[model samples]
Target: MTNNTQSLNSDIAAMAEKEFEGVYGRYRITSTDELEVQRYRLALLLCGVAFTAGLGQWLMIGPTWAWLWLLPMSIGLGLALNWIHIYLRPLHQALKLLWALGCLGAVVMAWSVGTDTMLSTVTAEPAWIWAIGPLFAALTGVGFKEFFCFGRPEAIGLTLLIPIALLGHLSGLMSGSIVMGLLGSAALLLLVLALRKFGMDAAADVGDKSVFAYLSNPQANEAL
Candidate 1:
């Protein structure tokens, strides 16, 4: 009788476990997803390096050739945006489009003024902000999504500092020193956020994969 009771209990536990998995298995993190998350984090780290290099160049703290970092900065931002897992597909698509447009504008601006004077041209012409603004806008979107998901102080700082610095420069409302200070702060915040992400579990950055599935299948989701 004792042996029979033990077997019955074990069977019951197995059934319950199977049922729980059936319902929630979609939420499980797979190895491939985790690997992808690592790639995304690496892209973010690259972005941080580029931002730091650009800031140093802006402040004349680095070699004049450091401005060449802009190419890698654009590449890193594109990769990061592509790999970021957002539940809303449309928003994700929009961010990529913005990045592309910004790149196109940058190329046009560079062509118009020549690579040698690109930086000086932008400084002399406030209207060029419109050309580069989309790139920063997409970056701001990334910062906002990170803050919304993780509530990180650095993420929120990037979201706020970017627009402030750009608008300040565009409107000529803030002194050059003030704009420089804000941009420097933004670069530091981005580096901090990127480094901190590495210490976090990849699942946190990947978010709820089930929600992505639900959103992807509108008809099936509505049927439920």
Candidate 2:
């Protein structure tokens, strides 16, 4: 190693030694590790479902009047984001299970909405029901945060979906429910597969967790 790198390595090794020895290591600047983004994804899905559940209370309040409380949920969600700095990720098997469930739900929701509102939509139930596509997509995505992995497929899929989602929603205003349902289902299923395949996989080390052993120790991932 060069003089500078050797010096830095010496320093880090010394620090690790001290911590392992129970020395005055409290003040040491150890690596600040955060949980994987997948963990936050679980919270995100809960948040989406929770926020939507508020719609029940919104129901009691009736109509556009419920917009007043939107700020509270928005702010609460903002504060929650701060916790991204600290968390422990779950195992890969769990992510796969969640992925399977999300895909199944996407298929069911699409089929149901398509069948129910096929003839006539735009009224209270259909409008809300049709919202399920994005709601499912968002919540499913929230359960599995794969922003990086989703780049190419998701970008293209969403690019293909947006105009259609908007147009379908808007068309509920003029076209029969059958047309709206058909259009909505067609676009949304595309998003479903792309997201399921890419978003569900376990990603790289999520946040900035230090890997002293992985970096310095020779056999960290030797088995894998």
lDDT of each: 0.82, 0.40
Q: To one decimal, what is the Cα RMSD in angstroms of model 2 from the true structure?
A: 15.6
- TM-score for all models, in order of appearance: 0.85, 0.29
Best candidate according to TM-score: 1
Evaluated at residue 57, the lDDT of candidate 1 is: 84
Off by over 4 Å in 1: 1-25, 61-64, 220-224
Give the per-residue lDDT of model 1 (tens digit) for 28-116. Answer: 56666777888888988898889887878867753345557778888988999978988787899999999999888889987887766
Q: After superposition, how far is residue 207 of candidate 2 from its true place, in Å?
A: 8.0
Candidate 2, residues 29-104, lDDT tens digits: the string is 2333223344444444444334444444444554344333333433333333433322223423343344444345
Query: Which candidate number has the best lDDT?
Result: 1
Question: Which stretches of candidate 2 lie above 4 Å from their native place?
Answer: 1-31, 35-46, 76-167, 171-224
